[model samples]
Target: MLKPHQAKQAHGDSPNPVLSINQMNLVYNSTRGPITAIRDLTFSIRKGEFVSILGPSGCGKSTLLKIVSGLLRPTSGNVVLADVEVKEPRPDIGIVFQQPTLLPWKTVLENVLVPIRAMRMPVHEYKDRAHDLLRLVGLGDFINHYPYELSGGMQQRVGIARGLIHDPAMLLMDEPFAALDAMSREFMMDELQQIWMTTGKSVLFITHSIPEAVYLSDRVLTLSPRPGRVIDDIKIDLPRVRDVETMGQSMFGEYATHLRALFKSNTAPSTRIA
Candidate 1:
């Protein structure tokens, strides 16, 4: 476990940081009053690092991702990606949501290329990259298939392919596999690990699952309940190329247990955000 100051120092010492959140805060002006979704959040993701944000529901995990992705502006603080302050949505950030959110009418290939089309960056130029990304996500054979024809996992793979097609500097994933059944979720976890290893993209994953965070992240940043703030920065020392077998190891269980305990100790009554 690293203290907040130590974590900041460690991140500062890194040769290259892909993303940095400095004293971030977000407050929503609801009719009732001002609600703080996040408060004084600070962290950084080094280039090629896979980091996960873990917290109880309504702790603003997804909200944090939005701020980082430039979808939402924070009331205070800053989100810097590659030394550029994010004011609006930029091409350098790619986001994967909890659901695949695929266009039913589009073929898998066409859906994967949506980003390219939306960015108006010469659809033809990204066609090859789309195909390669589909292959990378194990959807090469399903390129012509529609979203309806694929399983939940397959649809999510299409979502991953779409996120990567643009070749962004970092990927922001908001519980991308939370909807899958247990067996499918477990399988997709390994699949995601392979994708991250292959692409080496800086990833900021938001999740509620301790094991999932432990399995996929180089470091896990745990947040306190709503009005979210970083409470712990845990470095996972486990060897990479992790698999189903890796989950059975003592260190794996220890990391998961430690995170679970942290959450338990930090548990508090939080207002539900609709």
Candidate 2:
């Protein structure tokens, strides 16, 4: 459990927050009685910022995202988005999970249009928008293809395109590139950076890979194990333009080695955000 005082430390005296979670505690009351999923967890993310949450398994990372998305209510605490209390799912937030849950029957264009359709907006308005997004994700040529015809990375691109269709204020991704091979993952990271640079929306991305987190984020937030708490929030000092080759540089390797040692301490589940 996190100390009560530390739970809200990140929220105090900062610039106005775009997203705020205050003293959040999540508990599951199951047949086994009650289990604490996360206790006294808290943080705030600013608008147009790319923040990555990194932690070991069972840290309630997904649970925290769910809470922020209004898919789950905290047992105790508050999640405020854009100064509005997030009691229900707001369409302004986009989410992409590890798996691309694209409807098999829908073509790539149609899949990307799902969110737009849900908005009940005029098809003509979003049709070109969808095409532009597909192109942005490098899937313009495959718009008519089905999910089965696409590779894992391609499918994930479709998922990301779909998420962007509505032009959400923030994107919440849960290991969006974890399923891809190394090369594919690298490409996806570049694609994500491209999209982020262009859109400049707030992003809360969750990942288990240090390199991926470091490569894609403006800041990487490391969480401690079960009933997770923010242990450290490190800024990536690496240049905005980076790649696998960046790992060989002193600046990149310094941070990577420091983070590696933190995670390898063995006694503690340490993490890094840079």
Candidate 3:
């Protein structure tokens, strides 16, 4: 495993990133006391890069996503996006949570169109695009169906489509398939890869599954427990093109085992209950 400082020295000095964080720190102020979830962390993700952050439950992985999406601010550091500081929620960033969080009454097409409508963009311009996104997620025949009519996976499909509607520069996803069955979770992984390949979008995906992270990301960032900081940032050496067959290969198993052990032996306390 590469050391944290070495990883930073190698990947941090370069500059082709869509977003960059330098000496980042995040502390939650509560009535009890000040809690530091993340501390002096630093990393970068280049354009079109797929980065996965995996760690134990209280490692502040989701908290880091909040910072990147501009939903929360770092206490003493900066989050720079496309040469600008993210002071507040901007339309250019799209976020998807663990649950689908879709509007139950709206049909799939309507849900997908909400982002475009919220941005006050011409609806006509995205009508076909919306259909195209629905189709891309294998939901072409379900466009008019209401959220209640669809399965957990299908609703998530709609959520994915909605996130991409605005053509955000970056996508932040937090355990979006954690609530699904194992089979559905694997299916969602494939769907996400397809979308990422087609859109070439920069993505920061958070998950606790080592194989999932190793399979999906170009690079994986592992953090310590509370006051989480980089513990390991290893490149998945398996090939550029990943699929079921890739999972069977020895290299894939090696990487997965490596990551699994890294997390197992890691002892980071929870700053906040998840």
Candidate 4:
């Protein structure tokens, strides 16, 4: 693991990244004083690449996601998407939170179309697209089902479909499967990889699970304890179409082991590894 000073700017030399975070910093003014959540953070996500950000809890992992989605502005630095600076929420970006947050009253299909309705896009035009996305996520038959009728994993699949409804340039997922059971989480991992492969969209996934990150990412970026900054940028050379069997392979374990060591070495004493 590289020390803060030794950590190079992640993907600094990669050409044509779909999303770029340049020397980002975010501070929150509270009753106590100003708190810096992120410091000098820099990284890039290439087009159609699946990248994961791994760090201890409260290391600003989700905060970084919010900034990327333009929900929150950094105190300093910039988030550039496809050469355009993200100043406010843009219609072209999609976000999936830890919770599906699906509307209870709406059917799965209706929930998937919420973004389109909010953006004032022609609802009729996207109805077919929504059905296609649901089918892609393996929820074709559940399109008319309410959130209450689905399992936790099924609800999350709905969220994934909703995020892609607009065909955003990239997907920003903040631990989208964190709430699922162990079995469900594992299932979603494989499902998500298939979805990523099919869609060919850039993804910046945030998570605390080392195995999850290692299993899903083309590259994994580790951040330091609070006041988060990149500590290491690791490339996962494991072949794609990884399944449950792939997780048992030596290379997969090696990658997970290496990432676990990075957290142990670079994080503070209070930091907890998932």
Model 2, 1-274: lDDT tens digits are 2222322223332378788888989998989788787878778788888889988877788988999888999999998888899998888889999999999999999999888778787777889989998998898899999999999999999999888888887899999998889999988999999988888889999998988887887777777776777767676777777766787777666556655655555225243221
lDDT of each residue in 1-274, candidate 3, tens digit only: 4433333322653477898887899999989899899999998889998988887887788889888888899998888887788878888888888998888888899999888888788989998989998999999999999999999999998899998888899999999899999999999899999999998999989998888898898888888877888878877666766889989987777777767766766752343333
Cα displacement (angstroms), candidate 3, residue 134, comes to 0.8
Summing lDDT over every window of 10 consecutive residues in candidate 2, give the lowest-scoring window: 1-10
Candidate 4 per-residue C-alpha lDDT over 19-99 given as tens digits, one digit per residue, 9 for 90 to 100: 889999999898999888899998888899899999888889988998999999999999999899999999989999999
lDDT of each: 0.88, 0.82, 0.84, 0.90
List the candidate 4 regions with Cα displacement exceeding 4 Å. 1-10, 270-274
Q: Order of candidates by TM-score, top first?
A: 4, 1, 3, 2
List the candidate 2 regions with Cα displacement exceeding 4 Å. Answer: 1-13, 266-274
If scored against the real structure, what TM-score would every candidate get?
0.94, 0.90, 0.92, 0.94
The sequence of per-residue lDDT tens digits that candidate 1 reaches over residues 1-274 is 4333433322432456788888999999999999999999988889999999999998999889888888899999999999999999999999999999999999999999999989989998898998899998888899899999999999999999999988999999999999999998998999999999999999999999999999998988899888999878878888889988889998788778777877877783353334
Q: Which stretches of candidate 3 lie over 4 Å from their true place?
A: 1-10, 268-274
Task: Please list all clashing residue pairs in model 4, or write none if there are none.
Answer: none
TM-score of 3: 0.92
**TM-score of model 1 relative to the true fold?**
0.94
Give the C-alpha miss distance for residue 44 in model 1, angstroms: 0.6
lDDT of 2: 0.82
